[model samples]
Target: MVGRGRPPPPPQVARDEGIRPRRRNMEDEENMYGKLKFNMPKFKGEDDAEAYLSWALKVDKIFRIHNYSGAKKVAMASLEFEDYANTWWEQVVTLREEKGDPPIDTWEDMKEEMQARFVPTHYKTDLFNKLQKLKQGTKTVEEFFKEMELTMMRANIQESENQTIARFFNGLNYPIKKIVEFQQYSNMVELVHQASKAERQVNEDIKYSKSKQMIRGGLWTPPPQDRQALLVVQ
Candidate 1:
């Protein structure tokens, strides 16, 4: 009965302790999700299958704790990760709400949380991956050009200017991501117009590959400029 005078000891302490373990459990649950990668298919359902598929997933990290008594609060936080052609550079976006203020936390917590995030991806396009490898200094320019040319020859569509540009873009030292972007353009005009700084070089590189293919295949043709050349691109 003598301890009864202690004023029932603050109940917030007990509540906070109880919440911590549950929050940790939630963190563990999030880790269970792991990570995944998604690759955009080249040419809608061609060369093989006739099925369309999209990759998606979602998770909630509700166990985040909040503290108002000095340095033991968990603010609202959310993080998202996405993948590209290569799993090596998966995308992760994070948003946090903390103590009704901007995110504030210790280095340890930030480091641990960063290390905890999981991101996995794969090489969706072999040629694209090769291009990235060249950009990363992992592959040589010659190697990239070789595979790119082969891919172009194999995936040759329309056998027109667009396909030629795609081939040159694929062979460049630029990363696969940008090359894919160029290839996705609506038409040769858009492609040429929308091309990035790297893409300008692509236009010139295509000339080399175009002539090589012509010689190898014994295919020859003149420029599409005839009597309608009173106005030039210049």
Candidate 2:
């Protein structure tokens, strides 16, 4: 014989038994994620797009872990808002009304609308421009490369491994640049490794030069009486 309908939900473990304790443990495991406090940022407008995307990813992860059903996940995520986020929600509603579109009933649709408004073509262009001109200036080599990496991500510039290495190599300071050219580095890792060594050596040389100058104090001139003695010796 087989069951005709779905089984009843498990009860709490009031009297501990193998099945009841297991059921209670399972329930606790399922609900554990609910204890987490989501410190999501409130989106104001286009300028808040990055923060919104980050929060959206966090919410997506949490909802997935808790096994929220499609519509339920969407509904719960929509409700999980800080007070300041209300303004952005209102703006979305107003925009939808102006477009004469049917209400956005799904989180996916809302995300799409948010992207359409915020992640404009010009934003990518600006990121691309920044990446193109990025150089290792007063910033350390590591800091400069990190900025380049971020700009590349924002611009969605998917270069080949070799091309990325080349780009990074080109932006290095003259001394490091000269050394990097002669080395047959396979990828960015090797490039960065060699560049880091070169940069450290250069920095050390500069520090050593400064220390040497400090020891010298001033021009190496004989003292007044030493000058007279030197003249007699000459």
For each candidate in turn, give its C-alpha RMSD to the true structure in angstroms: 22.3, 12.0
Q: Which stretches of candidate 2 lie over 4 Å from their true place?
A: 1-39, 46-49, 57-66, 80-107, 217-234
Task: State the lDDT of candidate 2 residue by residue for 159-234, as single tens digits.
Answer: 7987888788888989878867777777787788888888888889877776677588944555699789989999
Q: Pick the candidate with the highest TM-score.
A: 2
Q: Give the alpha carbon lDDT tens digit for every residue of 42-110 in model 1.
A: 212122211111111111121222222222221212122223212211222223432344443542353
Window of ten residues with lowest summed lDDT in model 2: 38-47
**How high is the lDDT of residue 226 in model 1?**
32
Q: Quantify all predictions' global Cα lDDT against the true fold.
A: 0.40, 0.73
User: In candidate 1, how many Å is residue 214 off?
Assistant: 10
Clashing pairs in 1: 65-74, 66-73, 66-74, 67-72, 67-73, 67-74, 87-121
lDDT, model 1 = 0.40
What TM-score do all the candidates reach, one by one?
Answer: 0.18, 0.64
Error of 2 at 164 (Å): 1.4
Pairing residues by index, what is the TM-score of model 2? 0.64
